[model samples]
Target: MSKQQMIPFQTTLFVKDTCLCLHAQRAARALARLFDEALKPHGLTNGQFSLMMSLNRPVPAGMADVAHLLAMDRTTLTAALKPLERRGLVIVAADEKDKRRKVLRLTPAGEVLLAAALPAWRETHATLDQRLPDIERLRADLRALS
Candidate 1:
């Protein structure tokens, strides 16, 4: 088979400049870092805060539903829950209505912690929204991609 031509640095630069996924990923990491830092005093990272928030509900949420909402697989969701469980912030149990399905619930401590983290999350989120004009449009576009 003929050898493929080597790609040039200019093409790589063009890809970096124009790729939607690359830009989205970079923005996501940056935003996560900013929120993570903002949440440090509360002893939570952005991901943990999101995971906890996802479980906020009157009824415990099912594992598959949580995983789908988080855009993560079941295995990854399990790993993420480990630390929160250890901290007594989250409790996963068999769904009362359906014994086979595992349900996610925030413990009393988790509710308290999430309550405390809300102000921090709100502040950081507002800053992000202010920094990025047309944030609502951007979110809609991003959701379209998903």
Candidate 2:
């Protein structure tokens, strides 16, 4: 048989667009870019801002706890934190209760940076909210999906 005759093809027109994932991905990328641009003056990426915010709790927390809270793997969290640690924005030390586990805490400098980044973050957040007034509904929908 010829190649065209040998091959079989199925045709269907009911493939509905499940573009929710794509839309979410694009929105995430765009938001990240906006945050990155706003945070540039403070030398922080959106991820770093998130990490710092996560660490801002009253008590120091174990790396495992942070990983769980951030929905990030330990290795990935460690890699992301390295720059902050190196820059004196964060401190990683052995957990007081469990010597084998590491605890993460924000340093004074980290607090300072977070404070500086807050205004920029708020600005970007407000701008996005104003531009996309449906964000609250979208956030609710996203949370429902999660």
Candidate 3:
């Protein structure tokens, strides 16, 4: 038999052009940069804004729920919370119903900050939606993929 043929460079280009994961990652980075710039006035990166937003609820949320909702592991979620806690924007305490379980809550300060941040996020997201029509459907599709 002939020597095994080497993998072709064309295959590399094929994957680069055709891979959904690659395209999704690139789009995610681009969107992150856009939102980061938009939210800079509030001293929040897009990730921090999203993390804080995840805690906006009628009740203090459990770490696991927030982590799962954010697609983050508990360790990563804990690390993400540290800066916000240091800033006194969020508090982590034992759950009332289950004392051993730590729950996350936004403080009054955090609520104020988030309220201020909302307009920027809304405008930026609206602009993005304008550029990408049917964005709600796109969001639903992306969620399905996730």
Candidate 4:
């Protein structure tokens, strides 16, 4: 084929020189879609599931701490929490010690929803593991990047 004809019609550029970011983003999006479908019955999106899981571990986490752990900016995290708050799945309250700070906690309803979603999550995770046996390696690589 001539050089002009061989060239692709369109080329997409990622934000950076590294493919790692793009690959991770694409993988996360795909996984989120799959988990979203699986968690639909429990009325939880993958993001909500993750947030609940994070809050389930401890009693009331400061918003900043939770945001840091989730690697999300405060604004973005606040936006994500709105739906959960509306659904009564989570509660956000001002920290008593510091009125300016907010704390996040999973409500009883959130716990129940998380419990209902766990089986679906496990099945999806297992399927992914079966498909990507090298996931551990990928995880290690990703950790190294971090």
In model 3, state the lDDT of residue 96: 89
Off by over 4 Å in 3: 1-4
- Leading candidate by TM-score: 1
Tell me the tens digit of each residue's lDDT in model 3 across 44-88. 889889989999999889999999999999999999999999998
Tens digit of per-residue lDDT, candidate 1, span 1-146:
99999999999999999998899999899989999999999999999999999999898899999999999999999999999999999999997888999999999999999999999999988988999889999999989988
lDDT (Cα, tens digit) per residue for candidate 2, span 1-146 = 66555332332222223566666888789888989989999999999999999999999988988898778999999999999999999999998888998999999999999999999999888887898869899789978876
lDDT score, residue 84, model 3? 90
- Candidate 2 has its poorest 10 consecutive residues by lDDT at 7-16
Query: How do the candidates rank by TM-score, highest first?
Result: 1, 3, 2, 4
Show where candidate 1 strays beyond 4 Å: 1-4
**Which numbered prediction scores highest in lDDT against the true structure?**
1
Q: Better model by TM-score, 1 or 3?
A: 1
Error of 2 at 90 (Å): 0.4
Each prediction's TM-score against the native?
A: 0.94, 0.85, 0.94, 0.83
Q: For each candidate, what is the lDDT?
A: 0.95, 0.88, 0.93, 0.87
Given candidate 4, what's the lDDT at residue 51?
89
Say which prediction, candidate 3 or candidate 4, comes out ahead on TM-score. Answer: 3
User: Considering TM-score, which of the candidate structures 2 and 3 is the better prediction for this target?
Assistant: 3
